[model samples]
Target: MSGARAIVEALEREKVEYIFGMPGGATLPFYDALWDSKVKHVLVRHEQLGAHMADAYGRVARRAGVCTGTSGPGATNLVTGIATAFADSSPVVAITGQVAKAMTGRNGFQETDVVGVLTPVTKYTVQPLSAAEIPSAIRKGFYIAETGRPGPVLIDIPKDVQQEEVEMTFPESIQIRGYSPNYPVDVQDIERAADMLARAERPVLFGGGGIRIADAASQFTAIAELLMAPVITTLQGKGTFPEDHPLSLGPIGMHGRAEANRIVQECDLLLAVGVRFSDRSTGNFHEFAPEAKIIHVDTDPTEFNKNKLVDLSVLGDANRALTLLYDALLRRLAKRDENNAWLKHVNQVREELKGIPAYRDSYAELSGPKIVKLMRSILPPEAILTTGVGRHQMWCEIHYKVLRPRTWITSTGLGTMGFGLPAAIGAKLAAPNVPVVDFDGDGSFVMTEQALATAVEERIPVVSIIINDRSLGMVEQWQRLMYNRRFVGIRFQNIPDFVKLAQAYGVQGRLVGSLQEFGDALREGIRSDQPSVVEVPVSHEEDVFPFMPPGKGIKDTVYGTSKEMAVF
Candidate 1:
């Protein structure tokens, strides 16, 4: 078989049904082979979007997201998406077409040292030296991405390599030096951790995107249920705990829920599983959970004891570590200090949390959380939702009833501005039977709204709910709350009507003024067989509660509906 055909066959053997990418000169042979292959090639408007789709699809399906790009600008554009996936530990396989081997490193046309460019962001990166290595390279990429701490991996295929004929034999197994996916934590360590938790009066469960990546929400739920503790999911960790559950403190961080961040701060013991403590989640590190004894469990050793000093650093799969911990805890007698007082106090604090940012009745137009709740009610349980960065994303994080893991996919680590729409397109394609919706801020969408055409051409139906506030609402909120009404370069002035924007892409678009209109528009978008946009114009005055100012702790948040209004 030809090298190109062999590549396609390898992809097929790896169970890759879709490839998100752009055509490039060096990649002509691969595209030609893909022309008749069973694997569908989704031509994205930008290579960046292709990467985003791959990342989103990987997260949603719990498999590797496959994306391709050309040598120079195409490969460069894919960096952010790759970084996002890498940061969140999502499994993605990035295939790039490099210049011919003979022309490498001599300023070859469209050659940009893809391996070097992608190294920092990928778990592994390689440019195959020969056609015979292509199959192995592909297999290694998939294996590295899905096992242990999943992350993006890159394979750069030289133009000459793609043209060389080669035999195709899938690898029976894969091995990488200095890479181990499984870590068995010591039994004594588990017992010691259990003892610490059993002794603590204020214990909290904190989680991150790794929870979803591991597909271990049930294990997390088991721990919480057994301990009767509230959960504070990181922004990336949203949906690990049902947002509406009594123990759920929607996502704690810079813009976390009041009760959640507060509880995390007040806790005596915090068992953070598969969660890297990002600065955004912890806010100012100095003030972060000063009193909590943090037990950190992660697959990556680099993450161990890297952030807050860990009282216990268990190196293993998050699900497995959690399972061990729960089993050990269950085997031991229940702690005598089990009081529902703290739990009840936390629940009451959630109910009466001051500063629950509600808009003035004069501007009765729905706000972010309000719109998110309405949108959630309209979506099916199976329907997946994607998001871009900004206030809208935070609102959805707080209120969206993400019932299960992988239901929410967004750029949590990189905080990329233009990730939502493409991710929705990717999510929709990966699961064509389910409806995919992307709630984007006007500011965030305008950054990569060009992908709408890709969504249209691909027939990937994504309900894009544009929260049009006419400004970067998050920055504006910060300006209002912290900067003393000094709204600087944070406003989006004179934006186009998103409905008409969708129409120009030959896709459907609608605008909503009130709750009734919002419901009707979302209903139509979800039911529509084609791509559509629902522009829900939200009030600029809207704010997400439990906001920790810069240089403040997670506990230093302002509640949405605070009576005193100053203290979090």
Candidate 2:
């Protein structure tokens, strides 16, 4: 058998259903092998979109999504998507074709050191010197990407290696010298954490992406309910806890709900699970949770003291730690403490600021928050949503109600602008029965608008809700507030009509001016059998509020047009 055949056989053994990629010279042999395999090949318009698709697929399916690109430029193009996956801890296996082995160091056409370029962004990077190593490298890549702190892994196979004839022997079980994904949870740490919670008057449960990544949402929720603590999530942690639950305070951080931020600051004990406490989540590390004693539980030991210092740390998988914590806490506490003054106070604060940055009538002119709220009303609870990073993404973060885990997919950690459209495609592929929508800003959408071709060609029926603000909304907002409204190179003068562009790509397109029109368009798009694009023209002056400026604490959140309106 040929090396390419061996690779395909290995992928079949791994049960890889789909491989998102583009074809090129170095990958021709692999593609030939793929043609006769059970694995489906999704040819994308660009390598970057292919990578994003794989990332989203991995995130939604809870498996290692595979993506391939040829050599040099093709491999480099996958960088942004791969980095996005790495940042969010999404499990993805990127297979890039390398130049022939003999072309080493000669700067041959399409020859590049993809392993060196991707090492920083990947959990593991391997370039097999022989075809015999292909199966092991692929098996190990999938294992590494899908285990522990899940992330992307890169496997670069040279052209000669793919063409070389070799017998394939897929490894049933393999071990790496220093690679260990799971750590045993110390019962003493859980006991200490339970003690802290038992004595605490004000306890807050903070959940991050790890909960969803570990498939431990149920465990986290049980712990939160057992302690009757207010639940706050990070951007990547949005869907782990049901947003509409009574105890749910929604996401916290720079653009988080004002109530959540206020509660985090006032809490006495913060039980942070599967969270790394990123700078965005902790506005100012010095002032964040000053009064709270934080007990951090995470799988990665390196994240212990990387950001905000914790009173206690537990090194183990989120599922294991949370499960044990719940069991331990159950033994200590009999029932929810309804008479606790701290719980009453937390509820009072939540009620007081429930209307912060008030929502406009659905009939009024379209705004980011209003649009998202309307979409929520129209779409089913199970519908998945992806977003491009900007003011619009913030709005979705604020208003979109995620009822279940793995439903809210966005570029949270990296804040990649062009992530939405392709992500919607991948998400739809992962969950064909559920509706998938891409809530993207005009600026962000245009960056990867070419993805429409792939969606149309592939018959993916995801809807794209483009917030056409006619400018880089977030940048303009920053300029308006901090730079005296001196906007430069942000506004669009003569841009391509997004509706027309969508139509050109064989997608259903609608240009909506009013809220009713938008709702109509959205409904039509969701019901359509093919991909659709709904372009909504919004004012560039509209900004995402409850804004925390750089170098400021959560207490300094700007609620409305003025700082005086921050506190109600």
Candidate 3:
């Protein structure tokens, strides 16, 4: 069979239901093979969106999402999307076409070194030398992408190799020497962590994206409850735990939950699970968890002392580590005293933060949180929400309480704009029965608004809720707070009519001016069963509050007009 045919067969063997990409000259052979294959191809408007779609699919489906693009600019365009996946550890298999093997290093037409270009942004990159190596490369790409710390993997196939005829049989199993993502946790380490938690007066659980990646949400909850600790998730870990639960403090860090920040500050012992403690999350590492003895658990050992040094480091899978910790704690709890006062104090702080004057508005203008709340009421509970990075993303994180794992997807570490629409398309494709909404800012949405055409054409019905403030809200807020409100290049003088833009792409569009209009539009869009855009004109003057000034600790949170709000 031909190499392209073998590639398609390998994708089928992997049970890839959808392959998002666009056809180009170098990839025509692969597209030809796809014509007879059962794997559905979604032709995106741009290669970047194709990659973003695959990233979301991988996150939602808990499998390696596959995306394809041709050589040269086609491959280069996928760089940002692949990097976004890498930053957030989303598993994706990115396949790019290359020049014929014979034309190597000859500056052939549309030739570019895809593997070299993508090496930094991918978990692994391979340029298959021959058609015979295609199957193993593809299998290894998927394996490397989905194992350990999940990340994007790139495979560049030469054009000649695709057309090369070879005797190919899908390998039953493929192995890479000395590559292992999973490791056993030391039983002694688990016992030590359990003992620490058992004796702690104030304990907190810090969860990260790895919890969701490991499918350890239940185990994490068990451990948190076993210790009676307040739980604070990182931005990437927002939906990994039940936010509405009393023990939950939501996300922590800069632009994190006020209660979560407070809990972290006061805790004496922190069980850090699957978290890297990024600088953004721990502003000024010296001041972060000063009083806490952290017991860190992660699959990657490199992450142990890379950020904040912990008293104990258990290197293992999040699920297994958390499960073992829970059991160990149960065994060690006989002499422990109830931390009821700590829980009550944390709950009081949570309530006080909810009532803080900074995060609340007088309902003078349509706010992002209010819009998120209205949309939440209109959309089904099981709907998957994807968001572009900005004030709108913050609002979704703050107001949109995700009830299940994988229901909330966002560009966390990379904080990439224009991630929403494409990701929403992928999420909807991954779970057709579940509704998907892309919460986007006007500035962020415009970056890849072109993806709407793909959504409409492919029949990927996703509702894009554009919080149209006619400005880059997040940057504007930052300038307002940190830079004397000198909004340079932050304000949008000319705003496109998003409804008209959606209509141009054959998508249903609605312009919502008021809260009522927003709700009505959301209901209408959700019922349309078609790709649509609901443009909500939020107030440009409104800012995402409870802001933590740069270089300052979370305790120094500021609100409207740079007024410092005292965090308990």
Candidate 4:
């Protein structure tokens, strides 16, 4: 069999349903092999979009999503998407075509050291020297990508190698020296953690992306309820626990809920599970959860004490660790403490914070928060929601309710703009029966608007709710608060109407001016058989509040634009 055929066979063995990419000179043989394979190929308009699609697929399916690109520019274009996956710990397998092995160092046309370029953003990168190495390389790539701290893995195959013939035999199991995904949780660690929780007067359960990545949402919820603790999620951890639950405090960090920030700060113990304690989450490291004794649990040992020092650290998969901890806590406790003063105090704070004035938009008709609330009301609880990074994304985070895990996807760690549209398409493909929507800003949408072409061509019917603010909203907000509102290139002259652009790509388009019109458009898009875009124009002056200025602690949160904007 040819090496390219062997690669397809390996993908089949791994049960890869789809491979997203566009063909280039070096990838012809691979594409030719793919023609006869069961693995569906999604031809993206750009390599970056393909990478983002693959990333979202991995997030939704809980497996290694595959993407391919040719040498040089094709591979480089995938960098941002691959980095986004790495930052958020999404499992993705990226295959790029390389020049013939002989021309590697001579800088042949379209040749690039993709392995060197992608090493930092991938868990592993391999270049099969010969056709015989293809099968094992692919198996290891998938294993590394989907195991431990799930991340992207790259496979760079030379054109000559792809054309070479070999007798392929795929290995069922692989063992890489100095690499292990499994970590057994110590009984003593669980017991110690349980004891700490039991003795604490006030405790907060902090969950991150790892919970969803490990499929441990149920275990996380069990532990939270067992302890009668307040649950605060990081941005990446959204939807891991039901937002409507009484114990849920929503997301915490810079744009976190005011009540959540207050509660976390006051808590005596913070049980941080599968979280990295990034700077965005911990405003000023010294001031964050200052009074709390934090117990950090993660599979990656390197993450231990990398950000904030913890009282105890447990190294194990999130599901296994959380399961054991829940069992230990259950065995140790007799009954729920209905009269716990800490719980009552937390509830009181939550209610008190509710009385804080809601952000009043100058243009109430097209308010971001109100629009997001309307979306929540219209979309089913199980619908998958994706967002582009900007003021709009933050608004969705604040107002949109995600009831289940894997239903909410976004570029949290990397904060990549233009991620929503392609991600929504990828998510829709991953879950064909589930409804998918992208809450995108105009600036972000324009960056990857070409994706609508792919959606139309592929017959992926996802709704894109473009929050057309006519500016780079987030950057403009920062300029207003920190740079004296002297905006430079933030605003955009309304050229190329989004509704028309959507129509140009053969997608259903709707221009909504009022809230009712917006609702009607959204519902229409959701019910449509083809890809649709609902363009919602809003004021550029609109800003996402409950803002934590850089270098400030959560206690210094700005609840609205009415509050004094701190110049950091």
CA deviation > 4 Å runs, candidate 3: 334-339, 563-568
Cα lDDT of model 1 by residue, 1-568, tens digit: 7777778988999989899999899889989999889998988888998999999999888899899998899899899999999888889999988899899779967889888888988999977878888888898889989888899999999888999986666787877787778878777878888898888778899988878877788989888888888888888888888877777877888777667777787888998887888888888766777888988878788997677787888777877778889998888755333357778778777777643543222246677777788888888877899999999998877778787777888888888998999999888877889878999999999888989888888777789999998988888987888788888998767899888898999989888888899899888888888988888877787777656777776545555534435443
RMSD of 3: 1.9
lDDT of 3 by residue, 69-126 (tens): 9999999999999999999999999999999888989998999998888899899998
Please tell me which model should have the higher lDDT, number 1 or number 4.
4
Candidate 2 — worst ten consecutive residues by lDDT sum? 355-364
* Per-residue alpha-carbon lDDT of candidate 4 for residues 195-249, written as tens digits (9 for 90 to 100): 9988888999999988998889999998888788899999889898999998999
Clashes of each: 10, 0, 0, 0
lDDT of 2 at 40: 92
TM-score of 4: 0.98
Candidate 1: count of backbone clashes, pairs at least 3 residues apart or interchain: 10
Clashing pairs in 4: none
For each candidate in the order shown, give its overall lDDT on alpha carbons: 0.84, 0.90, 0.87, 0.90
Candidate 2 is scored at a TM of 0.98
- After best superposition, candidate 1 residue 332: deviation in angstroms? 1.3
